[model samples]
Target: MSEPSAGDPGALAARLAALPDEQLLAVLVVATAGRDTLAPLYEAATRLLSETGQSGTAPGVIPGTDMPPGYGPSADLGSSSQVDSGIGAVVGDPAATGGTVGGYTAGGVPTFGSLRDKVERRIGTAFGARQLDRQTPAGRGTEEQWEAREQAARERLAQIRTSLHEGEGS
Candidate 1:
């Protein structure tokens, strides 16, 4: 079957729920770590759901007046401004450390370098790919090699898919 669109919250939630414990934990860590970057993604997901009139419905269910779990209107939910400000407070302010209060430092700039070496590292031993180190000559060579190989593999895979389609048509 074709992949589900990212805008589908039900699909996304299903995918998240289907993940193995380790993978789910990894996703949670990544999500929590990149909460700042993911603000847009969250907004997009919510917007898409609202537009589809499925914001309050359960996954795979049609929209109606009754709100689903965690979907009910709250005092905070009354305004996008509140949500935006809350997200800004959580992400924009470097002092808003996880599970901690009153902890803003001068060196608290949340650069990718710091996040990679500090946040992600503390969350897990490794990540999907080496990003920062990939800038070095040697690292860049390795990354380029991997990318070239990956592109070749994708081309072959696409060709196979086309061939399969043609065979089915015949």
Candidate 2:
């Protein structure tokens, strides 16, 4: 694609508008797929439209950006075991270790619940609507779908690795 002429916002808009809805939607989908690779482009395009005062006439709404703040100093990040089991196993004393209740205990570190909380928080932050802090049940369902997709990716990667190793060994 050729670059737009300098300061030719109209030309740029025309180019984008010229794209078929399917192409535009494909661009949006591929860009927003998984980790949102096209997020910056999408953001820039939307901002361009808004700055040009043309957003009102844009085809659809531009999604909002609202990254949830991460956990504070006391936020717990779960351990490997805790993540697998969904339960923190006590390996030490709370008084001596200062670990949170239901957290993993390895080398006297108490950090299970906080980790889970952090993950949940991140899930909320990443998936939460800009307009709402607490996501609705349907939104939560979307998050679950994302989780399942992530798991599937991991499984596929593992399978690929195993196949490669077997091929090499054979």
* Model 1 lDDT on a 0 to 1 scale: 0.43
**Candidate 1 on 93-118: residue-level lDDT in tens?**
22232211111112223333223335
Q: Report the Cα lDDT for candidate 2.
A: 0.46
The lDDT leader among the candidates is: 2
Q: Provide TM-scores for the models.
A: 0.25, 0.24
- Cα distance off (Å), candidate 2, residue 40: 46
Q: List the residue pairs that clash in candidate 1.
A: none
Per-residue lDDT tens digits for candidate 2, residues 40-112, read: 6554543443344332111122323221232222323445652653333321122222322224332224355
